[model samples]
Target: MKRTLISALVAGCVGLASFAAAAGTVVVNGSTTVLPAMQKISETFMAKHKDIQVSLSGGGSGHGIKSLMDKTTDVAMASRDMKPAEVENVKKNGGEAVRFTVAVDAIVPIVHPNNKVKDLSMQQIRDIYAGRITNWKDVGGADARITVVSRDSSSGTFETWEELVMKGERVQQRALLQASNGAVLQTVAKNPNAIGYVGLGYITKDIKGLTISGKAASAETALSREWPLARDLYLFTNGQPKGDTKTLIDYALSPEGQVSVKEVGFVPVPAKK
Candidate 1:
């Protein structure tokens, strides 16, 4: 009886050890623009590291950074850099925020396929969102009021647009506000007169992308910085990541992960020499 009990105890201990060895979770939260690519990366990472799992969610860039600062998430995905106040806040809490550039992206202005306007100069786009140019005909389209769609203030995309396109101007108070790239795409795709923008990765055949200042938004243009709306995508951590978090961050900057970035329609980071 004693020998049988010892054997059963040893078997149970081995099972518990196996279960503990296979369990780890990495939580990532942030930008909707980065969500798709990260989702792909996470899937690949998990397959190779069967012991680790990645949990991802997108509430916007601000939320992601906030999650990191609050110690609720292992990583934060962002379409924009951390703000000055955000960095200061981290320092106050005895933590440092570190940013990792993950990909290059172009904020492509999208309109419905039926819209006749194929291109708009930078100033024209600014004017349209500023509510200074309200009619489509003013910009070479039909004689209809342009429905301006914009991302909300919390979005990193919105900050980039405000910097590059809005140019110190505000998106007119009446413009429709969306929470995610996909939402903006859908809003514009369904309305011929609507104009909106999204990360290059979110572009689909359903919406037509407008050229700005005669330059199309493409991987080549974005990487070359020839596209005026080009910007870098980022991942943020409380500090230099360690363990599972570091592994994921390193993979994202790895060649294979960069391929996933390109596959998802964003420009890959330039390879290191």
Candidate 2:
């Protein structure tokens, strides 16, 4: 009887060890715009799949792409599609970048709540960032000089702004360069004369979102592509993802994962027909 009991105890211990070893870890690194949603999804995913671990980090979209190319991370989150050059570089390194669109977002221009300017035409916004419109009064606001706050070159937010708002023109040298959408939101929130832009998910009551070309930035408009600044948020994997990587990505695109997107202030991808 004693021998049988000891054998059963030893078998139980070995089974527990095997279960622990089966747990998988997935590393995701990328856009700050996508960071909040990813963090929430990771939390929810891990809660359900207790054996899986998900780690997330933000260093702008460009840095994430580089990490993927260097084979340091399992997934790369991006607010914009990989540029042609970036795709070529990844291919040259013997990796094919596959993109998955997870959500929709709008680059909403924001200002201090005190700023009276409510709406800006497309040309007016272009001129403001290009240094042509130096004062808020030029766009129907206060007489103070416009303190431009902008994202850094490495940011996908900045690239999207460059394409939609700047239109090949450059943001003025006078603009303040911030590293993330959170930084831009904070800077604009605190300074009454400052104007900046951020992902729709980053908008808060602390800063006022300015209407672009008479259209308000919202999930409805963004998902429908009616918002002029609307863009797709993405996750990139080298070739097709398998195992834990595929599991995480699949979860992110699932209905439950899409709920996390809406909870975090971004538009969920529509359900498949």
Candidate 3:
């Protein structure tokens, strides 16, 4: 059979994998970081199902979670784990929220491909974001004011960056706020002096990904726990999945589905027994 392109609209933690999904339309909302993988998976899944439709929206993980609480979606993708308060809220709203680890994601520190500097330590990354290192020259690059790009507060990716990179200091207000992973890539790709953080899937030939603490970003690195900046990609379904939802979730976790995850530039989980 001839191969065809697959698409997915994922809103959550994204891992590298080959795209795959089952028949039927599934509504997903959450992290923009994972959209590439989701979009790819949707394409793969839709190819098989022929009749099912997947609608994807990205307003951040918070938005996805809220949409789940409101019964507006079938699945919610999240970058960060659910807060204690959020879990309670889900229960209160009669949502049977289940967290599924779909893929592994490395937080990619990217710059315009033209930048000369390469690897950075975690401390150096922190220094850059905290404004302690203000110039590209300070980091062994061209003499330019370091322009910082970031996601809005709604982004789960931003939350993770805060916990891992910012080390709790507030991000400076001067940073440019982007709405999604795509936006961040576009910004960094077009601006010579810009630096921004995005998910592993978003890093491409158009942008350059930096090494952090000497760890390189890759599926092998992330899956083996060798990458310090990587996290598990999650799909949250309120309670036990039913009907097509259950089938789709199963397909997503299946070997075929997982392979597509890697194809779409995410880290695939080990095959389950």
Candidate 4:
């Protein structure tokens, strides 16, 4: 009888150890634009879910989606939706990409705080990016050569800019291409003649956000769809997120997670009325 009890206790301990080992870590990779909010959400989540670990990294949205297709990441943070080709590629790789819209953001044109240009029409902004308006003076700024700063092609921010501002045209080769939104912000803030576009969250006192058609990029404007460059921020998962991946996503969509969205300077996804 004692032997039977001892054996049962040993099996119970083994089962408990196996359960603990089954708790896996979640890895998130992707868009720099979504990094800030994800970082905050992860922190809050970790505080509550001490058993699970969450890791995050930024490489542009394209890279993030690719990582998901490759099965390297549990989640992909994107500032834009997956492209058609990307959707097919994930399917071919034995995975389906599922997107969850977590927040709303606007791509705001930024310049050095010292820049005098305050407002630009959509056409003028388009002309500047296309390298047609090469001088700040042409756009009502000081007489200095316009230095165009742009996000790298892999960036979702760049994709949104192409769709909204460039239309079918290409950004001129003369433009300086930065890899991430933060890089664009830093470049624009440092160069008085430089102009770049970044997610609205990145706008700081060091850089001045340009008024598009006399409308500033703000949470109210973005949520109301009054900001011309407004777009949805996404979290992509392979297949329909299950296990820890689902838990993390659920936390991000929770009321507390939406609060983190607002605290991070981005607009939260609105609750159903």
lDDT of each model, Cα atoms only? 0.86, 0.85, 0.79, 0.85
Error of 1 at 175 (Å): 0.7
Question: For model 3, how does the per-residue alpha-carbon lDDT over 1-273 read when each residue is reduced to its tens digit?
Answer: 001221223222234221233446578888776666666677788788877777766678888887777777788888888888888899998766799888888888999999997888888888888888989998899999999898889999999999988889878788998988877887998999999988887767778999876678988888887888889888898888887777678878888888878886789988766
* Candidate 4 segments exceeding 4 Å error: 1-23
lDDT of 1 by residue, 1-273 (tens): 122322332342232211111238778888988877787788788888888888767779998898888877888899999989999999999899999999999999999999989999999999999999999999889999999999999899999999999889999999999998878987997898999999998778889999987899899999999999999999999989989989999999999999888877889999889
For residues 140-255, write the lDDT of model 2, one tens digit per residue.
88899999999999899899999998999999999999987777887898999999999887877889999977899999999888899999999999889999989999999999
* TM-score of predicted structure 1: 0.91
Clashing pairs in 1: none
Query: In terms of TM-score, how similar is model 3 to the real structure?
Result: 0.89
TM-scores for all candidates? 0.91, 0.91, 0.89, 0.91
> Candidate 1 — what's its lDDT?
0.86
lDDT of 4: 0.85
Top candidate on lDDT is 1
Candidate 1 regions exceeding 4 Å error are: 1-23
